[model samples]
Target: MVVLTKRELEQIALPAVQLAAPPLALVPEVDLSAVEASDAARSAAARAVAKACEDHGFFKVTGHGVPAPLLARLDAAAAAFFALPQRDKDKAAAGAGGGSPPFGYASKRIGDNGDLGWVEYLLLGVTAAGAAAAPVALSEGAESSCFRDVLDEHIAAVRRMTCTVLELMAQGLGLDDEGVFSRLVLDRDSDSLLRVNHYPARPEAAGEPAEVRRRLTGFGEHTDPQIISVLRSNDAAGLEMSLRDGTWVSVPSDTRSFFVNVGDALQVLTNGRFRSVRHRVVVSSARPRVSVIFFGGPPPRQRLAPLPGLVDREGGRRRYRDFTWREYKTSAYRTKLADNRLCYFETTATS
Candidate 1:
């Protein structure tokens, strides 16, 4: 709950060495407009989604029905908010004594160990069960009011779109009911987080060694701890994912599309059929970058385990033990940002 000031952030040093950039590969794209088409077309789109989930655990989505204008406004609002003076931004800081909500502004040096990223973010809860929660409150002022309005509108639209994608994913997984996934994710009391991230351009490290130059990261490598994440990033080229062979590939930045990533919860629910890929963002030295991510998880009280339907099809063996979302999230927050949080909840047969 500790918040670092701008001065403290500036004092943090970068790692002496950094990993080299990996080869670039395109993430598969799925045209979700098909979901509104005929049954045959819907089936085709579902199959494509299933394949992408099984093979890459990451993909880009197009024709998602969210208005481009809404995205632009959201982007503008974010840019305006982040451009504010440090003291103004600190008013929304999410830390002990910050007076902000639990899921609010977080600066660099996210962990107690001073593990830092070249980014700052505002996290807001988007859903409680299927219903929309109250819009995030902002300090009373004309500017804060406008920012709040735009963000609320954007969050509402994105939440609806995310649910649609989840339904299509369920269809592709042969869970014809579609509600199976949606029910688990959108249940009343289900907690979903919307994160608005801003990564400022790094200072040029002229003539520095490749390792030293690569040490600048917008955010470090890590897998998400939710059911799924829907992300949209401005054109800056930083997102990268690790392949099964341990090679890294840069993710394409398509402003018109949303990037979807399977998370640890989904991997467990699928009995590892889908992977939770490790990914990171490299800081750009020229222009600042902004991203909006919606992280979906089950209700805090819900116990997550391999879905019985999936387990039965996979010879009835559970790859992970049943654990409440609260328990898992608690464990996750206790560790370093990049650590494999899922390992703590793993259960062996003997246990």
Candidate 2:
């Protein structure tokens, strides 16, 4: 966590804009059970996932096969870890040192570029080998050992669920191969990461509208740069996602289910067929919000561009230039969290 001085705090505070409330209807949802059922059932589910991706670029997921007790254990473990003193928590992720943009613990600050938030997070890299080895500081103690165990189980289950969702996405897109999307994420060198975020409770005081004009941003709006992201959060209502129309809507939190959103890579791969949702979190009430998100990215060396199948078919034209995940990732790291990192890669023509 980056410590803030008085001058820094002023810069970190921003007014939360009050946007229009979305329709009463919640985001569309997909159930994973059908994928394991009859062929007809699978088709129906696949169409639903496809439609949600094309229309909203986001959806809620159910029947994901992860046990509620397991998630509860995860929450308990996370809470225990965060409740520790700052010094102890710092020692936990101190292994790789900071500013790698790869993994470890962070608080208040979002990235190296000074984007601050009312959030603290633990980010761990996972590959074919296993969940990231528990940091040395965390593994030394009995309690931390249990945290590591719960963390391992949680990552294993989430990874499987995420891959299944990706497969369904392929089916929905009418792709000939279901594994096309899933295989990249499962590669031995995949840069997939799991982030456990805790938003501390900050009660909003009732006061003159002018006095409350400024709101603390729990997290600023930004699009996930990976192919997809799977997110689960406790029953805290701090999440807000932007709609196609540019209006922001509050996403009601449900601890039992997960939320899925498209990322920039998917947008490019689909040649603009799907959109990457921009989202943020705000500290609204006295309750705190804890969210766990898994970002599934391809290997750093994997080249990214609109799939030839999409571009060459139906007179489609390439909208983006080819680049490796490493190139894009490096570019994204240099910018602010809210910058449209994809814009630079877009192709344009002159008469």
Question: Per-residue lDDT for 10 in model 1?
Answer: 50
Candidate 2, 114-136: lDDT as tens digits = 79888888888775755754452
Candidate 2 global Cα RMSD:
2.9
The global C-alpha lDDT for each of the candidates, from Candidate 1 onward, is: 0.75, 0.81
Off by over 4 Å in 1: 1-20, 94-102, 129-139, 205-212, 348-351
Residue pairs in clash, model 2: none
Model 1 lDDT, residue 341, Cα: 87
Query: What value does the lDDT take at residue 78 in candidate 2?
Result: 87
Per-prediction CA RMSD (Å) = 3.7, 2.9
